[model samples]
Target: MNAPRGTGPYVDAHHHVWDLSARDQDWLAGAALAPLRRNFTLADLAPEARAAGVGATVLVQTVTVADETPEFLALAADSDLVAGVVGRTDLTRPDVADTLARLRELPGGRRLVGIRHQVQGERDPEWLLRPDVRRGLAAVADAGLAHDLVVLPHQLPSCARAAADHPGLTFVLDHLGKPPIASGVLEPWASAVRALAARPNTVCKLSGMVTEADHAQWTVDDLRPYADTVLHAFGPERLMFGSDWPVSLLAAPYGAVLDAAELLTRSLGADAHAEVFAGTARRVYGLPGG
Candidate 1:
């Protein structure tokens, strides 16, 4: 129940944890993602988060199974560090609302604040607009959960349209829609992201840039354009910070991620900095304790 207090107790709005023994993360298959193949429980994240002054965090889903969300809720119920869980459910399922209700009735169900899907993995850019998906999203909105968008650059248009159509739901864009930072190009991605942000319901996370860039040689300067674009598009209140955790381990350590975020957002004033680091997350994901 710890809240954001003083200049510390920052909220990390996005991170992930998985137990390989419990279940396999099919997404962590590639050689490039081999580093994340091992188990990463909250225990593994707690020290780094605490050292970084991260008092609360929203644990995001890595897989698209119904079982994973319940496991996440159970983990949240037990962890002092994890204050919220943004889990996954089959959004295309007709029983989405009922499934969501069942999730809420679980152990840490009260901590279920948001839902996410592997929208980036979908080949079709307009998947969010599908009738079944829209219905599921409405169910999530009715449940009062924010929807975390993890789509590619081309998917931004549909994200914007979905947000416009589902005004009752809040859209939290993850990883800046996986910007093309490694290529050092910002055209279509930048413009598309701006269009998505134009929707009042949309918010963006300043996360995953290190991995998005040339992982081995990425610099804070390399991430500036994307970060700046999001900063300008969403401003402080509409923008939040996320570590992207285990995935971030591929590019940089935990503290380094926070350091780069600090450097990228140095231009913002104290209040704005606070918002990006903590306040925005607390507000957007509705993380517990202020």
Candidate 2:
């Protein structure tokens, strides 16, 4: 299928670049994650992104380290392909507001459009509701930045609660809350996603599905149900397309990922297609010309 097109360059709302030499990505230690241990730089990603017709991309945080955000901001500052960054900071810190201020003051800091944490690894399902975390979330709202939720399905209830508690903050759900596509189960995850979508402040990214499914044999049909669920729940306006690249390479090439997203949303009309492929991301991230 042809890649999805819109009135403007498609905004890839989620993707990442990491240099293993600068710092080890401890998560890449497993044998299953071996393919990603090497360096993935913007230079490597830019040509492919360009070929995919992606004009602007949002660089998302991969690790929980505070230093990573500044480094990502610096990278965004220098790159034309990267128009925004969803970075990481210690949200539990008492001085999170000040930390956010300091981050914003850094080079390319204006490109810091959002914040994210490894909420998927947390033991406590209610981690988002913890007093310290909630305080930090409020600080994020005060700074006029969004929070990216990279959580597992079971933890989604807390996500809904957090969104309810912080109506001013936009919660961008990454990877459709990491649904169980490999097993073909969607009930609880779909229901939970709908509940979260009930909050007007929440948004969902149509990303990471290729990796979530049976990597070697998955098809666009396998991803359609989940995509349809979010499309119905959030509608095109609150939904966005994300390549989830490098990580997405585990299951399919960058172009194949884009192709699958295009196929899944092919049923929509021209305007809805534009919203899913470009418009939603631009507005949600507050990117240029949004």
Candidate 3:
């Protein structure tokens, strides 16, 4: 379907899709993300996405299980709007290189643009700097795939260090390192996000900030600092917009997230807006016909 004329070319670079009947989402079983316990398919997201001027999207993984990776690949194979996928893999596995190779052979594995681990859930702050993890990251780089860092503020430095260590791999930080937005604290997170952005290969995703803020009353102002800081750090060339979708539903609707992003960058020139809206995502994920 063609996007309406005179509007932006938008691509929600971060979103998720899941079917509970097909497989369990162990992470959403808890209270924090309990609202997303049910299935969220493309049909449920497309209308909101289209209303927001999104022409395509990158489907991210919700579960850490290896089995789910292939499932997502299959889903992408059957969905045209799913431009790319950031799938999960046990990076610590000694056979991680083999795993990546095998995954590339799967149906939509060719669309496997990046790899992500639920590192934010790990107790170790230095989990990313672990020797095994570093080796696995090298395998991802060697396989010519981007590595998406799903981490917290505390892990930003280690994440930065990892990016520095592996210059060959493209590092995309998830959710601006998930800043402490609810309390309005910006010191360490801002500093860390900038430091990470200093690495040429590292880019940041403008996603998940709403959930980090007070869910009930969060507004565009609440999301500005995080977005502004990242924009300054990575600049429009390396930054991209993402909905976080059902996860974002905890704080606001999908269209609201796009509106917040649109409002935040209103001052940016049209060229810059075009890049942030869709160009950066196309460059990062290697979107079709880009």
Best by TM-score: 2
Off by over 4 Å in 1: 1-6
TM-score of 2: 0.98
> Mind giving the per-residue lDDT tens digits that candidate 1 earns over 117-221?
999999989999999999999999999999999999999999999999999999999999998899999989999999998999999999999999998999888
Candidate 3: clashing pairs of residues? none
As a whole number from 0 to 100, the lDDT of residue 120 in candidate 3 is 93
Of models 2 and 3, which has the larger TM-score?
2
Model 1 has an lDDT value of: 0.91
Model 3, 33-138: lDDT tens digits are 7898898999999888888778989999878788888988888899878889999999998999999999999998898988999999999998988989999999
TM-score of 1: 0.96
Candidate 2 lDDT over residue span 26-117, tens digit each: 88878888899899999999999898888999999998777899999999999999999999988899999999999999999999999998
Each model's TM-score?
Answer: 0.96, 0.98, 0.95
In angstroms, give how far residue 120 of model 3 lies from its true place: 0.6
| Ranked by TM-score, top first | 2, 1, 3
